[model samples]
Structure formats: structure tokens, C-alpha cells
Target: MAATEITLEVARYRPGVDSEPVLQSYQVPLREHWAILDGLTYVKDHLDGTLSFRWSCRMGICGSCGMTVNGEPQLSCATFLTDYAPGPIRVEPLHNFPVVRDLVVDIDDFMTKLPKVKPWVIREVQSPIEEGEYLQTPEEMDECQQFSMCINCMLCYSACPVYSLEPDFLGPAAIALAQRYNLDSRDEGADERRDVLSSPEGIWACTFVGECSAVCPKGVDPAGAIQRYKLTAATQSIKELLMPRSLIPRSKG
Candidate 1:
């Protein structure tokens, strides 16, 4: 027999009132189709209207509903409540970030670090509007396609042990997004992004624990992206040492 009700132990925090977060339990209907987000919604609507969390789209595309579900970083909308079965389901804010209220975390650090990598195409001179859009072949698009799937959900950051230990680490999503723009044939920003990506806080900070890729709901292999960039950075360093600056071809952006 399947249990109809399940206890959701959701973390609760209210600034200026609560010094720290506390787990508040709520009994919710455990339908087969009920996701963790659905249970949370039910709790908010019926049990406690003061319970706070961030969720949008509710379909996993918005990446706004990311939270720690049973010790794993996951999108609440995609994590079914029935999977946990007959008991309490632990739900909390993503790790390595300051909890704003309950499930909502402060993403100010990620937002600040993202722009440092210049995750955009760089062109020394803009082409005239009449020149039309920059074209890319299938092969060219494939180079950066895998890395471009990141939606900035910050799940990778939550799963990364390095980010937890070192708050200044550039983090998995930001590094992978940098690789996305770097590998894009239409983008010439690789040279511009190299300084940040090769810095102490960037790819070097990642110890290849690979939890970032494991927690990613978008199937983006951020660990692999970091490895790829490390190789590229290393190769560039070798060339710079062996070849004269004038002799080495400059990257045309």
C-alpha cells in the first residue's frame, strides 16, 4: 500500500527574527504526480502562507526552483515527492550561499563573478548592419553547444566542494559559460576571457571532484568544460614560452 501523506521538513528562516534557519515540518498529500514543488505550494496555500521560497515556470526550464532535496541539489519542480515515499522529505536552500529567507539563496556572488569572464562574443570592430548575422557551420556550433546549456541555476556551485571551502572560487557554471563563449567560432572573446579563466580562483580552484556535473539538471558537464579550458590555457602557455611574441599569430577577435 502507498502512503497518501508525506512529511516535508522544509528549512525556514526569517531575517531579523530568526538567527538561523530551522526545519519546519508539514504534512502534504503524496500523490504520484506531486513533485516537491507541488508539496511546497500546497503547504504555502493551505498550511502556512508565510513560508518563503523562490519558484518560477515550475517546469524546470526557468531554473528558479533549485534547492537541496534530501542532501542533493535538484530542481524542486522535477523532483517528485513520491520518490521519497512514506516519510519526511528534507528540503533546504542550495548550499554554499547565504539563505535569504528559506529556499531562496543570495546569488550576488555568482552574478558578480559571471561578468568577469565576459561570457559574450567579442569583436574588435562591429560589422555594419547590412553585413548580416555572423554565420557558423554545424561543426562550429557543435563545439560550444554542450557547454551552452547552462541556465545559471547555480546547482553546480552548490554541489562543488571547492566553492564551499573557498568562497572566491570562480565556480562551475561561470567557468563553463566562459568555455561556451570561448568555443563559439563566431565569438572572439577567448583571449579576453583567458586572464580570468586561468587565474588562481578560476579553473585552478576546481579540484575535479565532478559533483558539479552530477547535480546539474541541464546535463551540462561543467567538470569537462573546466578540464577542456585547463588544457587550452596550458597549450597557450607553452606556445608563449617557446615562440616569440611577434612570431606567434595573434587571436583575431
Candidate 2:
């Protein structure tokens, strides 16, 4: 017969109470359809009322249920408890981030760095309202569509070794989102983003570990985006060396 229950070793941290995070174990029914998030919910409702975590849409689209499950970054809402059957499963806040309460982590660093990349369509001059929206061909859309799939889930950042060591790094999600806009045919802010993208703490800091891509639940390859941006930055540097800035054509808006 299959196991009837599973033990979850969840990390708990409460400010002014616990000196450090402690693992608290709880047993919940093992159902085939139940996910790790469901197990956590069970603990909160039935086992421990003070258990805390962040989750919105149970669907993977929200990307808010990201956490470390058994030493790997995963979306607790999508990772079923049945996968790790017959034993204890560990759940903790995402790596490389400060734990807020229990499974909740402080993402203020990422929030501040995201805007620095200016991940939005920018135009020096905007057309009047009567002009309608800017249009793009399917081919043009394909250039940045992969990067646009990122839901700002910091899983990539948590899996990235570089971000763990260097907190100043702009991080995979921010860089990938930056490429989403930089590659957009209607965007003209490539030059404006050049300073941040090419800085020492930006793409240069990424060692291309590829963990950022491996752990991306959305199938987005942040490692590839960073590499592509590096090439673009290098080409721009060569052009500047060969010709004057005034002669170099500005990126199309």
C-alpha cells in the first residue's frame, strides 16, 4: 500500500522570538493531487496557525509561490508532494535572500534593481493619441518573446551562484527583462540602458553558470539573454572604437 501521510520539515523564523530559523515538522495527508503549497496550507490551517508564506494564484502563472523545496528552487504550488513520497520533504525560503518571517523573503533588492534596467518600451518622442499603438510583425515579436515570459519569479536569482556571492549583481530576472525591452522593435532606449547593462555589476558579473536557466519554471533562459546582451555590448564597443558616436546610427525606436 502507498504511504498515507508525509512529513514536511518547514523552516520557521519569527523576529524577536527565534534567534535563527528552525525547522518545524508537521505531518499531512499524502494525496496524489496535493502540491507542496497545499501541504503548507494544511499546516497553517490545521496544524500550526502561525505558519506564514506567500502565495497568490495557485496556478503557476502568478510566480508568487516560489520557494526552496528539498534544496532546489521550485514553485510550491506546482511541485506535488507525491513526487517526494514515503519520507520527509523540506521547504524553506528562497536562497540568497533575507527571510522575512517564515517562508517569506525580502525582495526589496530585486525590486530596486528591476527599475534600473528600465524594462519598458521607451521612445524619445511619443506620437499623439490619434496615431494609435505601435505595431510589430510576428518576426519582430519573436526576438524578445522568450525573455518576456519571465514573471519576475526570483527563482532564477535564488539558483544563481553569482547573485549569492555578489549581492550588487543586477540578477538574472532583471537582466532578462531588460533584454525583453532592448530587443523590442518599438523600443529606442537601448542606448539609455547601455550604462547599466554593461556595468561591472551587471552582465559582466554573471559567470554563465546556467543555473538561472535550469531553474526557470517559465522556460525562460536568462543565461542566454545575458550572453546575447554581452555580444551586443561588445559590438557597440567595437563600433565606438572604429567610428565617432555621432556617425553611429541610433537604435531604431
Candidate 3:
């Protein structure tokens, strides 16, 4: 039998009021088209205005509404309640990060780490203003197109056991974003990003658990990116070691 209404077991927490997060249930009308985010909106609008969560662009582009649904990380705006059917649904803040309140996890950690990987194009020299834009071949665009889809949803981080265990880990999304720029023919920043990404807590920290790729709604395979970085870093190290001592560049004191 199809359920007319579904119960949402939403996690609730307030800094001074609650010592720990608690699940609060609310029966919401089960519309086939309604997503879990809609149910949360209904709760905020009618049942409890105090209920807190994060959401934007209800279309899943913003990636702000990421949360643990039935123990799996997902964007609430894109997850249909009808899929679960006939009963209650569990919703909690994303794992592997500190919760800000209720469904909002503190993303400051990721924000801080993102810049360290330098997820942007770099050029050794500045082009003149009249020179127009840097061009890339079709193949070049294709090289980074898949990785460019990441929305910073952090679902990958939540699903990553390595990141959960080691907070310093550069993590899947950051490394993949770095690769996104690194693969760009217009970007000459691979060497700049390599130092941070090749460090102990970067790509090497990933054990290729692949859960990061599995949980990504955008289809960005962060695991593959990490593996690629490992190979590239290893090959560069070998070349440097093999090069004659006289040919190696040295910095002046």
C-alpha cells in the first residue's frame, strides 16, 4: 500500500539548549514529487519554525543541503521521499565534520583546505589584455570536464573513511578539484598544486576506498583523480631522481 504520509526522523540540535543532537519526527504529506528537502521546508513552515537546516537552489546545484539520509550522504533537495516509502526516513548532518546546529555541518574545514590545493588556473606569465583568452583543444576540455562537475557537496567527504579518521586529509573533492585545474591546458598550476597534494595528508591519504565516488551525486570520480595524482607524482619523482646532478636546477642562497 502506498503511504499517504511519511514520518521524517530529523535530527535537531541547539548549542545551549541541547547537549547532543536528537531526532524529532514529523508526519509530512507524501507527494510523489516531493523531495526530502520539501518535507523539511514543510516542517519549518508549519510544524516548527525553529527547525534548522541548510538548502539553496532546490535543484541540487548549490550542494548546501547535503545530509545523511538513512546513513548515506545525499543532497536532500535531490532525494525523493517516495523512494523510501511506507514509513519513517532518517536525516542527520553529514558525518566526518562537526555539526553547526541541526542539519548544517561546519564547512569551514573544507573551505580552509580548498585554497591550500590551489583549485584555480595558474600561468607562469601574464598575457597582455589585448591577447584575448587562453585557448584549449577539444581533448583538453574533455580531460577536465568530468572533474569540473563537483559542486562541493561534501558527500564524498562524508563517505570517505580516510577523511573521517584523519581530518587533515586533503580529501577527495579538494584533490579532484586540483586535478580539474591541473588537467586544464590553460592552467600551468600543476607544479604549484603538487606540493600540497603530494604531501602525506593529500592524495596518499586516500586508500582508494571508492566510497567517495559512489556517494557523489555529480558523478565526479574523486578516487580516480587521487589515483591519477599518485601516478603523476610518482613518475615525476622518478624523473627527478634519474636526472643527472648537473642538469637539476638549484635555488641560489
TM-score comparison, 2 vs 3, better candidate: 2
Q: All candidates' TM-scores?
A: 0.96, 0.97, 0.95
Candidate 1 TM-score over all chains jointly? 0.96
For candidate 1, write residues 128-220 as lDDT tens digits. Answer: 989999899999899889888888899999999999999999999999999888888888778888899999999998899999999999988
Tens-place lDDT digits, model 3, residues 117-222: 8888788898997999999899879999999999999999999999989999999999999999988888877877878999999988889999999999999999
> Highest lDDT among the candidates is held by which one?
2
Clashing pairs in 1: none
Ranking by TM-score: 2, 1, 3
In candidate 2, clashing pairs total 0
lDDT of 3 at 54: 92
Total backbone clashes of model 3? 0
Report the Cα lDDT for residue 232, model 1.
80
lDDT of 1 at 68: 96
Predictions in order: lDDT: 0.91, 0.93, 0.91
RMSD of each: 1.6, 1.3, 3.3
